[model samples]
Target: MITVDFSLFPVGPGDRVLDLGCGGGRHAFEVYRRGADIVAFDQNENDLAEVADMFAAMRAAGEAPAESEAAAETVTGDALDTPFGDDSFDRVIASEIFEHIPHDTAAMAELHRVLRPGGIAAVTVPSWLPERLCWALSEDYHTNEGGHVRIYTRAELEAKLKAAGFLIGPHHHAHALHAPYWWIKCAVGTSNEDHPLASAYHRMLVWDMMKAPKTTRTTERLLNPLIGKSVVVYLRKPHRGSAESTG
Candidate 1:
């Protein structure tokens, strides 16, 4: 499921895109389908292999536009150190990834380094309030292997992006509907797949995603303004000649 809205990122056909830390390749798939030259960059070789296989499968099935063949590639690399030349992609997407990195400033710098002048990057992180609640509700939620290391306030995240050489853009919250499901998971046990309450909530979420029920949809719309689970922020690298500030 997409946490960040693509409209805010505003990519087009022929755009060179990078989905940083592209676990399981959800956002990367979207980029390829839109006729973008996409690289799913991650350190996990196995994950890259899976994403590469899916890319081939999609090409064979014509699941993407006929123009989409080989437009997608997978790169195994550290987030703090992407392998592309400087100013490579027109757009970069780093969703649900910042929290996992300890040196996120360095990672942000790397994202800034790889974007062409004026190219945009979209970032999604766990919203502070909902994430705080999750942490308060369950230790397992943030303490597990590869679990989130920290929750970021929007201001702090925005500041880091700006410091890393990005111009701030419109920001908003998303995935309100999924917040409660996580809260429920924490209330029971983060890994409690068989717990009755968690199971019921999971099914409801599945139905919501597949069926898009009006009741849940409307509720989420209302809740998103209040306590959405994910915070999406758009950023842009300044075009050449833009003034840089130390302030």
Candidate 2:
């Protein structure tokens, strides 16, 4: 499911987008379908291989618009030191990734460096309350290797982004319906995949994704502001000579 609201951070034909730490390429595929050149970057070789395969599959299935010039590629790299040159992309997406990086400021700086002035970066992280509940429920939830290393309050996230030279823009919460499912998992042991309640919740989520019944959709929208599991913020690197840029 998407955490970023495209209405606030639109991508279109010819736009070059970077999906940083693209674990399974969900957002990358969306960008490609929207007719933007997309690079799905992650450190995992196997994940990148699968993302590459999916790009081919998407092209073969004619997923992009007929006249679209969008291209898709996968890159394996470090977020702190990406391979692309400075000011390379029109938009960048860093979804649910900052929590896992120890040097998040450096990574944020890199995000600012690669984005063209006035370009947008859509960043997401676990919302503080839900994430705090998970941590309180189980040690494994955050302590696992490569798992979330810190919890982010929205104010802290915005402050760090501002320190990295980005002007914070609109923000919102998303995926409210999924918060309880994770809480259940944390309660039952994060690795216990066979717990009946967790299993039931998983099925329900999959069903909700496939069908998107109005009842659940409406409920999620209502609940998103209060308890959404993920919080997404859009930020812009200021253009040169602008007041926001100089100050």
Candidate 3:
């Protein structure tokens, strides 16, 4: 499911977009469909391969706009040092990615470097309380090789982004219903696929995502501000004139 709100960080046809750490290419696909030139950047070759295939499929199926100049590609690289030139992308999306990076400051700097002046970025991380519950529930959840390394409070994240030269904007929480499902998984076992309760909860979540019934949508909207599992922060790179003044 998509985590970043497009309304808050709107993109247009031919806008250059980067989906950093694009695991499974969910956000990248959405950007492509919106007619942006999208690069799905990830370290996993297999995941990139799948994302590339999906891009081709979308093109073949005529999912992208005919008059739109959108193009899709995949790039495998380090987040701390992507290969793009400075001021490259018009927009960037980094969802549920920072918590896994050890050198988050460097990665943030890279994100800042690649985005053009006045460009917008949307960053999402695991919210503090729900993530803490997950870590408390299971050692396996955070201890794995690529698992989340830390939970972030909103303040900590905003500070880091500002330090990286981004001007922070309004933020919001998302995916309120996901917190409890993850808590159950962590409590039972991270890999306990056979657990009945966890399986049932997973199925329910899948249904909610696929069908998006009015009741569940309204419930999630009401619950989002209170206990959303992901906190999304929007940031903008200052224009050169404002950059000098802010500096």
Candidate 4:
């Protein structure tokens, strides 16, 4: 499910976009469909391979625009040190990834380094309240290999972005419907991925995403203010001369 809203990100056609730590290329796919030149960057070789193949498949299937030929590439590298040159992209999306890196600042700095002046970054993390509840219910949520390493309060995350030289912009909650399912999973067992109840909830989420029923949409709207699963912050790197303008 997408936790970041591209409308808030403001990417137009022909923009160069990077999806940092793009696990399975979910967001990257959306950017490509929007006609942005996309790069799905991740450290997982298997995931990169799949993303590359999917890009080819998408091209053949005409899933994108006729000019969708701008195409996406899979770049495998560390988040703290990407292979591209400085100021290499018009937009960057590092969703649901900051918490995984122990040195999240370095990763944020890398994001800043690669963005052109006025470029936007959309960073999503587990929202504080729901995430705290998950951790309270299950230690495994935090301890699992490559699982979420920490929970972020919006303030802390925004502050870190500011320190990395981004002008913190609009921010909000997302994935409100996914929070309860996670709570159920954590209450049961993090590894119990196939348990009947958890499995049912998982399928329901897939349906909610794939079909987007009105009922789930209404439910998500209601719960967003209360127990949203993800916190998304939009930020931008300032032009050299305009750093003081934010003041």
Best model per TM-score: 2
What are the TM-scores, per candidate, against the unseen true structure? 0.94, 0.97, 0.96, 0.95
Can you write out model 3's per-residue Cα lDDT over 1-247, one digit (the tens) per residue?
Answer: 9898999989878699999999999999899888888999999999999999988888889987553477788999999989999999999999999999999989999999999998999999999999999999999999999999888999999999999999998899999999999999999998999899999999999999999999999999999998899999999999987843222
Candidate 1 TM-score over all chains jointly: 0.94
Pairs that clash in candidate 1: none
**Model 4 pairs in collision:** none
lDDT per model, in order? 0.88, 0.93, 0.92, 0.88
- Runs in model 1 lying further than 4 Å from the true structure: 67-70, 243-247
lDDT of 1: 0.88
Evaluated at residue 176, the lDDT of candidate 3 is: 96
How accurate locally is residue 119 in candidate 2, as Cα lDDT from 0 to 100?
94
Instruction: Score candidate 4 by lDDT.
Output: 0.88
As for candidate 3, its clashing pairs are: none
lDDT of 4 at 81: 90
Model 1 weakest 10-residue run by lDDT: 63-72
* Tens-place lDDT digits, model 2, residues 94-187: 9999999999999999999999998999999999999999999999999889999999999999999999989988899999999999999999
Model 1: per-residue lDDT, tens digit, 7-34?
A: 8776667789999999999999988877
* Candidate 2: worst-modelled 10 consecutive residues by lDDT: 238-247
Candidate 4 lands at a TM-score of 0.95
lDDT of 3: 0.92
